[model samples]
Structure formats: C-alpha cells, structure tokens
Target: MTATVLTIAGSDSGGGAGIQADLKTVSALGAYGASVITAITAQNTRAVTAVHPVPPEVIAAQVAAVLDDIEVHAIKIGMLGGPALVDCVAEAIAGFAGAVVLDPVMVAKSGDVLLPDDAVDALARRLVPRATLLTPNLPEAARLLRDEAAGDGAAMQDQGHRLRALGAGAVLMKGGHGGGPTCTDWLVTDQGAQPFTAPRIATANTHGTGCSLSSAIAAGLAQGMALADAVGRAHLWLHGAIRAADGMRIGQGHGPVHHFHELWA
Candidate 1:
C-alpha cells in the first residue's frame, strides 16, 4: 500500500523549508505527500521578507478535508508561526492515530524568530504533549528548555528527557546547531536516551535540513518503518542529500539539499 504523509506548515517560496521541503522529502522517500499550508512566506535563501498567516479555521478545514478523504498515515508539522496556529493544528490532528513528527521550528535559517516568544509556552503546553516525536535543534531546544546549559550534549540529553516529560512519546534533540566536528542528536524516551552521530558536512545547501529530516522520519513512519529505523534512515538520507548538493548551487545564499540526488546520477 502507498503511504500518504501530510505536512501542516508554512509555504517557503524559496523551496527550501516549510511545506515545500516537507513535500520534497516525503516524495523522495516514496511516500505520497499532501499539505495544509498554515502560512505563506515571502522568503529566499537570505531572509523572510514577509509572512501572511492562514486563518485558523481554514487551517482546521484543510486538515479535516484531508483526513476525511485520504488515508494519512503520518504527519510532519513546521513553521506554524504563532500560538493560535499551533493550537489549531494540534486540535486538528489530535484524533489521528498515526505518527506525528513535530519540528519545533522556532527560528528561520537567518536566525530570525519564526515563533512568537510568548508562543513557546503554548507550544510546550498544547502542541508538544500531542506529538509522537518532537524534533528541536540546539537553539530551539535551548528556548524550549530555557537553559543556557542546553548548549552541551549532557544538558541536551537532560533537556530531551524533560521534553519527553512534557508528554511527547519521544524527543529528538538535534545537535546540528551545536559546535563540533560531529553533529550529535539524542533521542529520549521513558526507557532512556540513544544518540545518533554523524560528521558535520560543511555546505551552504543546508537551508532545509531540519524540515527534511522530520519529513523523512514521517515518511518512514507512514511506510511502517520502526521509529528508530526511521530516524537512522533519515540521518543517512540527509547526509547524502547534504553531500550531493555541496557544490550544486541554487539561490544566492544557502541553497536546498538535492532531494532528487539519487535519481540525478
């Protein structure tokens, strides 16, 4: 059976992150990709020029329409942009029995805050608890954990545990934003924490790494892969995507990883 995965996210005109990247990653992993755009962003590799949020009712309607018609097996959420949007999405997908991958995309690639400072509370209280997996990069984890110590791996592991306590089934604290030769991500559950480590590939085509990773995980779940297996495959796929697109350039600033890297060569 073909797996259908949904992305509830903002639209990135740059084709890097948000729904654009989510769709690409889902399709690249051989899953049918569907989307409910939560916002429309005027953005490029360098910056987000403007953001227009979709109405909460419309967002809910889209989720309803999709769930009503399609067999959605998994969901990947990103760039909700505010508390209201986050709540709407959380409420819409609350009934879903399948996997949900929440990428707490609090900031843009240029370091601009994507979510409101106050919405962090709403995200933790309303959305994080509903997620099957919460994927937060170092900066996002720091914001969620509210700790300067979150910059270290040990602190990150503890933070992941705390995040799991926030009611997530699992918490994947991404260490890509942390400085080191290897990027280490910690997956924390009630059982314990397991780390996934990979060498940091220096490349400008990293604009969609977080979105792509979560989407890949969602796709794997949709296809019925085990949770740990999905994460490992996502890590491998993203590594290849980053390396394959290293010399290939697109926009003036950070470009997108080659989602079709395998098909091209």
Candidate 2:
C-alpha cells in the first residue's frame, strides 16, 4: 500500500510554502498527500499581503472528512491562524493513532508574522503535547518558550529538552536561521540529542525549507521509517534541495527550494 500523509496547513497562493509545499514534499518522497486548509494567504515569494482564515467549523469539517475515509499514516500540521483554530485542530486529531509532525509556523520565510502573539499560548497549551515530532526553528522555539533564541549548539540542546518537557515525543531544533559555515539541526528524543549537520549554502531562496523538511519527515514516518532515520533522510534531501534552489529563479525575493531536485536530475 502507498503511504499517505495528511497536511493541515494554510494555503499559499505562491505555492512555495504552507499546504502547497507540504504536498510537494510528500509527493517528492513517494508518499500520497491529503490536505485540510485552515486558512488562505495572498502571498508570493516576496511577502504575505493578506490572510483570510477559514472558519473553524469548515476547518473541523474538513478534518473529519479526511480522517473518516482515508487511512492516513501520518499528519503534518502547519500555520493554524489563531487560538481557537489551534484548539479546533488539536481536538480534531486527538483520537488519531498515527504520528503527528507539528511545524510551529510562527513566522514566514519573508519575516511575516503568521501566528499571532496571543495564539502562541493557545498552541502551547493545546497542541504542543500532541506532537509526535515538534519542528521549530530558532525564533519559533524562542517564541514558544517566551525565552531568548539559542545562540549556540549547547543552548539549542537545552532549548530542545525544555520543549520536550512540554510533551513532544521529539523536538527538532532547526538551525537554518543561524549564521555559519555549517547548518546544524538537533533532534532531541527520550534517548538524547542527535545532531544533523550540513554545509550551509548561501542562497536567499530558502522560502519553504522548514515546511519542506517537516513535511518530508512526515512522509518518511508515513512510509514506516524510524523518527531518527526519517529526520536524517529529510536532512539530506533538504540539503540537496537547497543546493539546487538558486536555479529555480521563481520570484523576485526568497524563492522555494526545489522539492523535485532529485527527480529532475
């Protein structure tokens, strides 16, 4: 049977991120993709101009529709617009027996605020504990904890542990925002922290990298790979995707990584 992954995220008109990116990543990893849109954004590679949240009732209905019929192996969640929506999504998936990959999309790649200031607490209170793997970049991790972002590897591990205390089965502290010759992502589980590092590629076209990575990890999990193995495969795949990102030239600002880099070559 084909592995199927459900993506619950906002829609990005530009197709570089959100539900678009998640579906693309899932397909590229040889998994089937399903979706439940929580919101819609008037956005491009440059910035998000406007956002229209889907009504909570509609969002709930979509979730029910998907879960009722499909044998979804894993769920990748991103960009719940506000507190009520966060609670809505959390409750909807409470009985799901598969892995849940939650990508706390607090900020867009273009530096736009996707999650509101008030909704942060709601997300933490309701959804954080339900995550099988919590994927948070530096600023996101800081925002979730109401603390400063980590400045170093040790700090990253500390933050990961702190986040795990909130009840995530594993926390992947993404290091893409860090400035350095190498990029490092820490995966913290009950066993301990394992670091995945790659040479940093200098490119402004990193728009949907975080979304892609988390989605790819979800796809891996859907295909029955172990969490660490899933993370490792995604790390390698994203590195290649980023290396090929500059060639796409999709927009005037930050473009998306090539989700189909391997397939195209």
- lDDT string for model 1 (1-265, tens) is 8899999999999998999999999988899999999999999999999999999999999999999999999998898888899889989998999999999988888777789977788899988888999999878887887866476778889989888888999998888878879988898888788889899988877998999999999999999998888998998898889888866688988888988887776
lDDT of 2 by residue, 115-161 (tens): 99889998888888999999999999999999999999999999999
Off by over 4 Å in 1: none
Q: How does each model score on TM-score?
A: 0.97, 0.99
The C-alpha RMSD of each candidate to the native structure, in angstroms, is: 1.1, 0.6
Checking candidate 2 for backbone clashes, the offending pairs are none
In lDDT terms, how accurate is model 1?
A: 0.89
lDDT of 2: 0.95
* Positional deviation of residue 94's Cα in model 2 after best superposition, in angstroms: 1.2
